[model samples]
Target: MTMTRRYVQDLQDGETIEEVFLLVDKQLRANRNADLYLLATMRDKTGIINGLMWNVSEESMAQISAGDHVQIKGKVQLYQGSLQVIVTRITKVASDNLDPEDFQPTSSQNVSELLEQLKSRLLGIDDPQLRSLMECFLIDEDLMDSFSRAPAGVKAHHAYQGGLLEHVVRLMEMAWRIGDLYPEVDTNLLLAGVFLHDLGKVREMAFEGAFTYTDEGQLIGHLVIGVEMINEKVAEVEKLTNEPFPVETALRLKHLVLSHHGQYDYGSPKLPMTPEAIALHHLDNFDAKVHEFARSIEDDPNTDSHWTPFSPRLDRKLFKGAN
Candidate 1:
């Protein structure tokens, strides 16, 4: 039976809650007086929250693991401008009793509909070689399935399921506008770059249970992985078309993947050198930054405040507008 439960995002300070949450991570820590406490990061579709249980025993830690769906009884409170729960009790919920859907955050966008739009946009590219290259990836059902399910990032912009697809589609929309404005820009190549730049994220991210990096993801990352993925598809395009893929075209596409991050400190292997590459870099940043700011305001638990807490990652507090 389906059940409605209070989600983490709806939690308010001073309110007591008893709800089940996905246990994303947990640590046993010692206080100054040597008392043990359990620090846990919990989630449920809406957002993630931290909970602290004071004077916990070793046996209590044995009751729950990082991926378990556990029932928590706690009081929500604001600490240092952020909200957290002071957990009084926690216990593992029987897996058979609750649906996992209640705990995973999915995209607000429809997956199948967005995918069709994505295919139509890519398939519409007039450049035969580029279209064939995109078809190579699109024809791979397994990869497309992963792409549709993967989050764009673990914590930043579009962190939920299907976020990668959403991010790419939004970029495609922007690419169309930008291409129209700059007639010199190759729209086909720009579209291909947009699709391929983050294709490696399907492999880079492991989203089956918890959103996190795969072992290969931590080692190589999406940029290098993306270049490799494009080469593999490029080979398929050549074999299928019975023609050699253009060397310069392939190199330029790879540049878009490697240089999309835009800077040395941001992990781009090469800086944007081409018109397409520079356009992609700025477009990607513009989308990601705007999403981060919007998400910050939406997820801010401080309803009474006009500004969100200073984000160390973003390095600035977002204005929430006059309340």
Candidate 2:
């Protein structure tokens, strides 16, 4: 495979660099004098960087859009201890010349192995009905392929390819380890909830290029979509068994999907009402938050300081503890 000329992670302050990047975001903004400037967010598999081009007309970037491969000439500068580029010139390039793998962030874990682990846990559920429901999803080759490649989110926690699989499998492991402590918690129900909670993300996120939401994802959202998916699979499972799926069991499973977000402000249509639902909500939140914190520390550009700059998303600075 042909190598990338330069990656965002390799950029250094005060360096004059020329490279091609995936233009993941762009904005035409007005400056202090009301003059127009173009702000761009560029990316590669390694990371992303922002660039500013001064004195540019809106028409200058009229044809450029996010997801287009672009070539840029710029001088790297450290702004507030983070690197950004003072772009001299930028223009879109033909993707025919570039490899898509060089621009998309993929998970470090082996996706197939992660999928296998997920299967082993869900398939082990002793509840006959729950196991049958899981089998309906597991046997769908296309769904499993997308699930293995979908991101947990566009830019938060586990956002790379295969991230959904990685995040779900970790939640399963954590749920399994805590089983002894929460003896009253139904392990079968909790495990099924964990597996199904974020399953809608496979359709919600588009990872073929830049990670973005789909039309169904934007209009309907994942919580509702997840419940819809479960209902469809429940119908199939019933057909296979020639018996009705337990109504209460299906209701509890749907509750886990809808309430996993924990609160109305977070987009959950319903609050976690059951012990299993409550447990899934907290465990999902814990894993996502911890991953975000660790990524902030690892991706912080200020190597000279022990603390990362204030993150607007996190609402606080993270300490790296004296380099």
Model 1, range 221-240, lDDT digits (tens) per residue?
A: 99999999988988888999
lDDT of 1 at 47: 94
Cα RMSD to the true fold for all candidates: 2.1, 1.9
What is the TM-score (0 to 1) of candidate 1? 0.94
Off by over 4 Å in 2: 1-4
Worst 10-residue stretch by lDDT in candidate 1?
1-10
Supply the TM-score for candidate 2: 0.95
TM-score of each: 0.94, 0.95
As a whole number from 0 to 100, the lDDT of residue 249 in candidate 2 is 98
Clashing pairs in 1: none
> Ten-residue segment with the worst summed lDDT in candidate 2?
1-10
